[model samples]
Target: MVGTSEDLHRLFSFYWFLEAESRNTRSREWAEYFTLIRTQIDLFTMDKFDEELVTQSREAARSKPLKFWSRYRISGGALA
Candidate 1:
């Protein structure tokens, strides 16, 4: 379990670096991908931890509402 956690952590680190470095171009995709991977890491890391940690995690998530641009939306003009 420790090794698996470490590997996931490394993947999260790599994706985070990619997101930070490519903030100007294709950042949303990278950011969303990072978020997905981060979720896995957070779940694994906190699975055996205390309830306070879980509560803190939920609080942190609640504090950050997705931005306008970050909201997933399809782009297309209406037919005339």
Candidate 2:
């Protein structure tokens, strides 16, 4: 399992669509999503993606409740 509320599995919670995409086990979709994250992450550069990275991103997001923009990293970090 990913984790509980305390842990909150930020990767899954924040990247809920990714979790769904993974659960569906669609490699093409995951690849597209992975590519999106790699090419478009604004704050930091990432060569690879994993649960830890996802969680860290989510945590960073939580620190600022007032931020208006959506940080959802979709295909090539495109706006959805």
Candidate 3:
């Protein structure tokens, strides 16, 4: 979930932890995938993303090369 820049950053931070904890190539791959998505999030936010950007962001992530986290999606909330 992501309501603001901080929220998105938190999600990315979790992904960072996942990347660090990964033990296999697949897990690591997913980590890099999420990292890219996170980078997009950061850029999208910096660009002042509104509803339109939100849609674009999701779509962009959907098109990523790796789809390990296809089931996961960013929404209007925070990780915790």
lDDT top scorer: 3
List residue ranges in candidate 2 displaced over 4 A: 1-4, 19-70, 78-80
Instruction: Score candidate 2 by lDDT.
Output: 0.44
Model 1, range 1-80, lDDT digits (tens) per residue?
A: 33343343344444344344344445577667656765675675567545465455444433432332233232322211
User: Candidate 2 residues 2-53, lDDT tens each?
Assistant: 3333333343344444433444544776757755653454223233345565
Give one digit per residue, the lDDT tens place, for model 3 in 8-41. Answer: 4444444444443343335556667766766775
- TM-scores of the candidates are 0.34, 0.24, 0.32
Please give the distance, in angstroms, between residue 48's alpha carbon in candidate 1 and its true position after superposition: 4.1
Q: Provide the overall lDDT of each model, using Cα atoms, as 2-decimal numbers.
A: 0.45, 0.44, 0.48
lDDT of 3: 0.48
What's the candidate order when arranged by decreasing TM-score? 1, 3, 2
| Candidate 3 worst ten-residue window by lDDT | 71-80
- The candidate that wins on TM-score is 1
Q: Against the true structure, what is every candidate's RMSD?
A: 11.8, 10.7, 12.1
Looking at model 2, the pairs that clash are: 36-76
Better of 1 and 3 by lDDT: 3
Candidate 3: stretches off by over 4 Å: 1-26, 49-80
